[model samples]
Target: MKNYTTPILILFLFLVIAIIGNITISAIGLFFNHDVFNTGVYANGYEASLNIKLIFMAKAFALLMFIYSVYILIRNLKFLVRRDFFNNKLVQCFSKSGKLFFFSGIVGFLASICGILNIAIIKDFGSQAYLNIDSKSLYIMLMILGFFLLLFSKVLDKGNEIQQENDLTI
Candidate 1:
């Protein structure tokens, strides 16, 4: 229990801001990039009209949810300092965080899969200015970590019950 609230809070906020920025840019590019779409990125007559904006937005959405789960997991750490180890809120946080992380990871990975299935011309891979990077490996890690956290939460709940019963006996 290193009291990781502050750092995690900062990370959550940063991820939120990044998601907002991504959505904003994606929406702007979708709604208004007509001026540049035909001339700039579509240089080779690759007529993939179905842009991958939705996939990009989907990844952003997943990242937002993933960080939000982490935010919830760390939000109630005050109970840990108070030596209240058996609080239901702590268990609930872990449970909810695990579920959300799993869901987010699945969504992100599926989005990537869909993106890959699309015609490559639907999105410009080389013309991006470096900020449009998305990582499949990251999503895979999220899925694995989420599953472990879920199992850990169950173990923690059982331990909490045992500790409470011992306390009552004394």
Candidate 2:
């Protein structure tokens, strides 16, 4: 089973790279081709100079964090293939991956908030800014998944101790 782990890890790494590439390309296209700057008006019914660049920067930062988390996960998977599942290094890798996942979720949530606030601040005082909760759910899911991963690392640590004891008895 361990012999197959390497190939699977490689496949997943390639998949993550592909996904990142696609997202980068699409983001570049959207940022350059769309007229996002002139789309919104100020609270006083005047054309406001909305800093569209900040929106792009926030999105890019979130995407980079997500990519970084995926990279950490892939690195951990590679370590799992090369070392014992119960090894200290493997535990560290798992812990790091979990933290990265949680961090990515926070960064994504903040990005959404920044984007929404940017629009709201410039919009008419009485008019409501569109609040989309779709990304919020995804962010929450990421946080939960990260928590589970941390819990799993604890379980693996216990398993490692049991395996060590069994080895000594054998």
Provide TM-scores for the models: 0.76, 0.61
Candidate 1 Cα deviation (angstroms), residue 149: 1.6
lDDT of 2 by residue, 1-170 (tens): 57776776787678667656655554443444432333343323542133444444555565566667666666666566666688776776677777767776777677677666766786432211222212766767777777877888888889889999999999
lDDT of 1 at 165: 91
**lDDT for each residue of candidate 1 in 6-27, tens digit (9 for 90 to 100):** 7767877887787677666655
Q: Which candidate wins on TM-score? A: 1
Give the C-alpha lDDT of model 2: 0.60
Model 2 / residue 148 / CA error / Å: 1.5
- Per lDDT, the best of the predicted structures is 1
Candidate 1 pairs with clashing backbones: none
TM-score for candidate 2:
0.61
lDDT of the structure predicted as candidate 1:
0.70
Q: lDDT of all predictions, in order shown?
A: 0.70, 0.60
Error of model 1, residue 37, in angstroms: 10
